[model samples]
Target: MECGIFHTPYMRPGRTDKETFEYSMMLAKAADSFGYRDFMVGEHGMQAWENIPNPELLIVAAAQVTERMRFAPMAHIVPLHNPSSLAVQVGYTSQLLQDRYFLGVGAGSWENEAVLRGQPGDLSEAHPRLLEGLEVMDKVWRRQPFTHEGQFYKAAWLEAGIEAGSVDHHDAFDLKDGEEYHALADHSPYGGADGLEIAITGLSAGSPSHVLAGQRGWTPVSFYGGSTLLRSQWDVYSAAVEARGDVPDGSRFKVARDVFVAKTDEEAKEQAKNGALGHAWSKYLMPVYKKYRILQGFIDDADVKVDINDVDLDYLADHVWLCGSPETVMAKIERTFEQTGFRYGQIAVNTHDALDDPAPWVESLRLFATEVVANIEVAGSKSPVHEFA
Candidate 1:
C-alpha cells in the first residue's frame, strides 16, 4: 500500500496563523523527506479553529520545499466560486507544479461553512451545483471552445490563444472575474496540455457522490471511516463503475485515518489524550458538530452507540484513532485492510496536532515509514478486475 499525509490544518488554541502555517508546512516537508507518496492539505474558511481558506496556496508553498511528492488541496469547495475561474486556476496550478498535483473537489459540506463562504445552500442543494460546476470545469480544460448552460452555472468557452510572444492574436475570451488563460493555440505542437487527475471526496458511507466518481473513472477518497464504513463506500463506487462497463480497482481508492504514534501503545494513548489532537476534537470539533447537528456519524457507529455527551478521549482513542507504537498501529491497519479488502489503495493518515511536540511526532512519521510501511505487503492485482471477479 502507498502511504501519504493528509493535513486538515486545524487551527488550535495558543497558536497564531503564522505558527500554525509554519508547523503545517514542516509536516509536509517532513513527509517529503520520509518519501511519502503524496501530501494533501485541506481548506476551511471562517472556521477559526481550521483556518486555511485556500489549500492551494499551501500546496504551492510546500512545492518549493519538497521534491517528488505530489501535492493536492484535499478539496476546493465547488459551490462557493465560479467553475470557470476554478478551471483556469487549477489548470494553471497543474502546469506550474509540472503535472504533479491532483484536484479534489467537493460540494460545500457544512451549512456554517456555506454561510461563511457566502453560499447559504443546504447540502441537498450543494450536490447538484457540485456536479454542474465540475462539468463546467471539465469542458474548459479540454483546450477547445465550448459553451455550457446548466441550472447552477453557465460558461462561454474561449478559444485557445497564440503564443505569448505573438502579437498577431487578440484575446477573444471573456473570463470570469479573477480568471485568466495561459495555453498555446489549439493547433500548436503543445496544444494538448497535461491532463489533471481529479478525485472526489466521499465524506459519508455510500454517498451518491461516489456515482459521479465511478462514471468519470476518478479516484474515490473515503473520508474518516473504519473498515466497515469504508467498505460500504467502496461497494457503492465499485457498483457504479461496473454499471459503466469499467473495472473496479481497489488500488485507485484512498482511505483516510486519524493516527498518532509513540514509542509504545501506552505512551501514544497518553499523548493523544493530552496533546493538541485531543484538544481539537474535544474543544472545537465536537462542539461544532453538536451545534451543527452533524455528529451522528461520529457518535453512532455500526457496532457501537455512544451518547455524544459521554464521549471522551479514551473512547475516541479506542474506536476512531490509530494511536500506538509502529508495530501496534501497523497491526490495526492490517486488520482494517483485511476486513475491508483494501489491498492497494493509498492509506492516507490524517495530520494531527500530535506533531506539535516535534520530537515524538516526527519520530512517529519516520518510524511509520521505516518500520511499518517497509514490512507491509500489498495484494497486487494480476489482471484487470471485472465486477465481482
Candidate 2:
C-alpha cells in the first residue's frame, strides 16, 4: 500500500498559467517531503485551455526541489512528434536524471495540434505507424544502428559516428553501400542508454498484443473511471505476463487517479462540496461522456441524480469526488485498498483540482498521509470490500 500523487492541473479558465505551473511544482515538492513514492505529471501541448504544455520541463524543475520524490512525465504526446527524436530526448533526460526517467507514449489528440501538423482524426489508430515509431525510437536509445524500411520512416544509423568511418551519409547503409548500418550516438538532451524505461499505453481490452507489452516488461497505464478499473487492468495484464511463463518486473503494473485529502472528514467534505466548480467542469465534459460512455456510480449503490448537460453540484460533490476528513478519507481509502489492493494514489492537492484554493487540498493530503494511511498500514487491515476490479 504505497501512496503517490498524480495530476493534470485541470486547466480552469480563470487560473493564471504561471500560477498553475508554480502551484504544480509546489505540490510536487510537498509530496516529496511527505514521503510519497512518486510525483507524476501529464502533458498537453498547443492547447490554450490545457496549461502544462510540456511536462518534461516541469519534471526537470521538480527534480531540483525534491530529493526523495520519484518523478516522471505521466505521459507524453508521442504520435505527433518525430518518434526517433522523442526517444533521443527521453534518453538524454534519463542520463541527466542518472537513469531516473521513464517514457510514457501515446498517440496525439487535440484537433488544433493535428490541424497545425496537417493531420486528421488521431494517430492512435495508425498502429503500425506507432509501432514503427517505437522501434526506431528504442533502437536510437540503445544506439544500435538498425535499418527500418517498413511503413513510416527508414534509417540505418549507429550509435558510433559513421560506424568507424565505414559510411559517410544518412542514406549510406551496409546493406546498400556494402557497409554495416551505422550512425552517431551522442549523449544528447534525451537520448542513449542511461536506462530509458518505455511504456506504451492503450493495449486494448484482453487483446493478445498486451502479451507483447508483457514481453518487453514495461509499465502499462490507462485512464477513466475509478480504482477498481485500474487494478483489474493491472491484474489482467499481469496475469497475461505470468501466463507467458515470464516473470515480469512486478513494479511495472501501476494504477493512477486524481485524489484530494484533508485533516478531518468534515473539513474534507466542506472543501469539496463548497468547491462546486466540479459542476462547471462536468458541464464541459458531458459530451465526451456521451460520445464514449457514461459514468456509473462507485461503491454501495450511491445513486446520483443529475442531468448529463446539467450535472448537479450536489451530485458531483458527493458522487465523483474522493475527498473527506481524515477518518472518512481513511474509510474510503481503506475500502479502495481492501477492494482492489491498489498500491498507488495520485493525490490531487491543488485547490482548483477541487474547485477550492490550494491550502485546503494540500492540508488534506498531509493529514491523510499522517493519520489514515498510517493507521491502515500499521493495522495491516484485511477487511474485504466489493469492487469492480
Where model 1 places Cα greater than 4 Å from the true spot, the runs are 160-194, 287-308, 354-356, 380-389
Per-model TM-score versus the true fold: 0.83, 0.76
> Candidate 1 lDDT (Cα, whole model)?
0.72
Clashing pairs in 1: 11-49
Backbone atom clashes (below 3 Å) for every candidate:
1, 20
lDDT of 2 by residue, 1-389 (tens): 34555555565666677777787778887666666655667767664445676777888888888776666666676556677777767766666675446667665445666666566655544455566777777666665557777666766664354444454554533456755444445654343443466655442334333444676666665543444454556566677778878764433444444345566556656566565335434544445434433344242224545545554544544565566666766666555555556543333232245434667666666665565555554232221111101
The lDDT of each candidate is 0.72, 0.56
Candidate 2: where are CA atoms >4 Å away? Answer: 14-17, 109-112, 122-126, 158-185, 188-194, 200-213, 224-228, 247-252, 276-280, 283-291, 297-311, 337-356, 376-389
RMSD to truth, every model:
6.8, 6.8
Question: Which candidate's TM-score is highest?
Answer: 1
**How displaced is residue 35 in candidate 1, in Å?**
1.5
